[model samples]
Target: MKTATKINTRLVVFAKAPQAGKAKTRLIPALGAAGAATLARHMLGRTLDIALSAAVGPVELCMSPTPDDAAWLGIAIDSAVQLSDQGQGDLGQRMACAVQRVTQLEPVLLIGTDCPGLTPALLQQAAEQLGAHDVVMLPASDGGYVLLGLKSPCPEIFSAMPWSTAAVAEISLQRMKALGLRVWVGPMQHDIDEPADLDHLPPELMNL
Candidate 1:
């Protein structure tokens, strides 16, 4: 199927509203529920800032609980950000839904508010990659991916599969290969999902 001609890279940043006990639950063990939520809020803001600064295309924040939810009350999202609800599903299902929805508008670079290493330069690089390749992804040190850029909706890659295990990235690569999709895997980066991952936090986040 012919994909939409790439316009601006439709950047989608996925975030769970940083509510205590709901966001960053794994880190709650070390930082406590409040502290973990504080950290989550910081990370979400930082990710949005980075995404907007990239200026690669229109920035959309696909928030869970929808933008109208009280869970998002007082969270200062930028005016320039277009908001959308992630609706319902597991990680893979929500992601597949987002990809399917946006790829029709333009090629999308879907990222989560996790990787501090996902810089504007890297996002631009991935945007460029999506122009020529079928798929581009920034691998996470944990077995998953930090960013997924696609020129078309390839749900098979995001379908029923392990979401959190280290095998996630490899399995995705295998799935893409089976479908004969071109894939660009960027350098691996750390995701602050566990307490030990806090050690990888950059200086800006060290204060947490």
Candidate 2:
């Protein structure tokens, strides 16, 4: 069989400002709201550094409403590309729309800027895997996904599904199966969504 050629993957990082009270609200009790947001800012910075360093193609920073917000929180974003929210709908709709928008021109990888375990090598691996699969998912320990790469746009994965719950990954997989698309599974990782999630975070990060 002929090996598939590499396609330039656009890496889209979804991130938010690390506001003291607005960020990481779930972890506030254990870490204090300011501490929680500080940690969130740290992780977001690390993730962005990795993405910037490891990116093999275009790096798009899909950020919260305004550049000023990211600026105030010290979240370094690529200013060249204008940022936009995933919209008013749930997470799934935003992801579906993002993939659709990018897949129109090139293969795309949409990732959350919260998975500390993610690195350039892993992002590269996700990009390479997309050659063989229509959808590539890096499962998060919280029963969700950290990274999602798409060779072809598929909206069904994001429509009518529970968002921010343990069912996310399963529902996505089921959607892929139903569509008969070849799905690729990357290494299982974790996203910091709750107080319990702190244990898996980097030690230095845990301190904040």
Candidate 3:
């Protein structure tokens, strides 16, 4: 009997330290500094849980403000999971760097901690699609992307683009087309960012 070969697909979670005033600042007006940070912490935990449950492959937590920050002490991550700094630069530079580093080991699916709708099945679906597509994007309802997976490093897709605007997904697809990279897009999902987005939060996190 022959054993089936496993694909080397990594789930890279891009997260910020859930510190008051530093995390989820956009929602602070509605939830206060502490409350917003609490929500950030909850979202990060949920994201991590979903990634682990997906069991697609190894998981990495790419932290902003570094992994040594005290804000990480509140969450319990499996010691087996890899931890690394998000490195210097804007969102584009940071993601490009992270993707470059991880793609050396295996293809990577990069995601943020903001989307509560991200599930294990969705992560698995993205990973599975990467086996055929050059890139896979899970578009967000807010015009950004909730997830991005790449079979290989393509820095052009991440460079010189506006980060927080509605044009993000549109511009990204344009760049991918310019590079002649094939893209697979998943269903749209929502992220918890502004006060209006609070209604989408899970019931347990709605107390805020």
Steric clash pairs (candidate 2): none
- Please give the RMSD of candidate 3 to the true structure: 3.4
lDDT of 1 by residue, 81-168 (tens): 9999998989889989999999888889999998888898888888877777899989999989999998888889888888889999
lDDT of 2 by residue, 103-159 (tens): 989999898877889989988888887887788889998889999999777888888
- Show where candidate 1 strays beyond 4 Å: 1-7
TM, every model: 0.95, 0.90, 0.94
Tens digits of per-residue lDDT, candidate 3, 1-208, equal 3222235689999999888999999999999999999999888888888899999998899998889887687677877678999999999999999889888879999999999899998998888888778899999998999999997788898899889999999999999998888788999999999999988888877884
Global fold similarity of model 2 (TM-score): 0.90
Q: Which of the numbered candidates is closest to the native, going by highest TM-score?
A: 1
Better of 1 and 2 by TM-score: 1
The 10-residue segment with the lowest total lDDT in model 3:
1-10
lDDT of 2 at 173: 96
Local distance difference test values of all predictions, in order: 0.89, 0.80, 0.89
